[model samples]
Target: MTTRVRDERGSAAIEAAIGLPAFVLFVGMIIAGGRLAIAHQSVQAAAADAARAASISRDARTADATARREAEASLANQQIDCRSTRVSVSTAAFRVPVGQAADVTVTVSCRLDLSDLSVPGIPGSRVVRATMSSPIDTWRERAARGFRIPDAYADVWGQS
Candidate 1:
């Protein structure tokens, strides 16, 4: 009985040494997945903000500038740092004729760095992208011509 007990004394230590690394690697993967999910949500929010800002503009030229600024600001507010970032806007719909519905589209992309995970077979970076659209105000004038009050409103315009 004494001889058998001596042989088993160091087995637990040896097993722990062999299993620790695998266990740590599994935990690391879970953390990396969570980080990716956060990045994705941030990108989506940025896209939504960009589209909303652009949709309020009267023309494609101003919409383009507004979208870019809103997207950058949103990402900064969310505290997301990307290895690379891109914001794209599609304004084709804004050129529609008056009385027709129009929409502004914004797309955001970010390359998230995963180097800290130090896991093999996983890319050092991954891309996350989101797209969103917001409708342009149907009644807003598209050009600088502006809008004139209707005959019905003209009588009441100065009464107040």
Candidate 2:
């Protein structure tokens, strides 16, 4: 009877040891998935802000600068897992010099700011990116009304 009781206790201990790890693994995955979803939304918002900034500018250079600032600012304000961001604008006008009627393509990228979250079991630092485009012709007109764009677009001044 003493030997049987000892064996039962050992079996229970072994089962607990195994079960604990599996339970922890499941919970960690759920948390990581939630973090990923938040990061994705932040990236999408940054991208949309960048595109809006670009569309309000008259030329590719101005659009790029405005979009970049907007993307960075958006990410900063959101304060999500997005630690770094870059934005760029490419013109679809197929012209040597981007002009008022140019269609601008905006791209925004963001990545996890956590350093050395180096554990493989946790969320791998992720990069989320998005792109959008809009025409600048209407923006040029709006500017004529003395309506200045936001501060992020300040770099685009006088470049129609």
Candidate 3:
């Protein structure tokens, strides 16, 4: 009687050929997820900064301009290169009278590019948006009022 042995040659190579693509895909997913997370945090921070800047402005016109500038500067500082950006400021609070609680809202939108990652399932670009609100100083004077006083002085003078 004769016995035959099975040949196992090239089995390792076959396994590696199948596994390498899967490993590469997993790494790509991790990179894409990390990039998205960082972008989200950056956008949130930009919105907060913009809202704060707008809240401090004395007039609606100034608030709109200030919010846009602050958002752009904040994103640039973080070294985020956006394909497109949009900053929207809600100045309705500016119309509210002093001594009443009011807040300014700023929305920041950024289009992030991810084509270089070459991730098959992921989109070439993603739009990330964040909205933040900052309370306007209750005692601070508005454009309607001719008087303008610092927040510290407003409290000291019992403006509230």
lDDT of 1 by residue, 1-160 (tens): 3554445879889999999988998898898888778889999999999999999987888889999999999999999888888999998866776688988999999887777334555667888999999998777777633445667778788632
TM-score of each: 0.79, 0.64, 0.83
By descending lDDT, how would the candidates be arranged?
A: 3, 1, 2
The TM-score, computed over Cα atoms with residue i paired to residue i, of candidate 1 is 0.79
Q: What local lDDT does model 1 show for residue 37?
A: 88
In angstroms, the error of model 3 at 129 is 0.5
Candidate 3's C-alpha runs over 4 A off are 1-4, 116-123, 145-160
Over 1-160, each residue of candidate 3 has an lDDT whose tens digit, in order, gives 9999999999999999999999998988898888789989999999999999999999888999999999999999998889999999999998888899999999999998887334654557889999999999998877844555667789888775
Ranking by TM-score: 3, 1, 2
Where is model 1 poorest over a 10-residue stretch in terms of lDDT?
141-150
Error of 2 at 42 (Å): 0.5
Query: What digit string (tens of lDDT, one per residue) describes model 2 on residues 93-156?
Result: 4242325465667777776743423235443466778887766663344332244556777778
Better of 1 and 2 by lDDT: 1
Clashing pairs in 1: none
Error of 2 at 82 (Å): 4.3
Q: Cα lDDT of model 1 overall?
A: 0.85
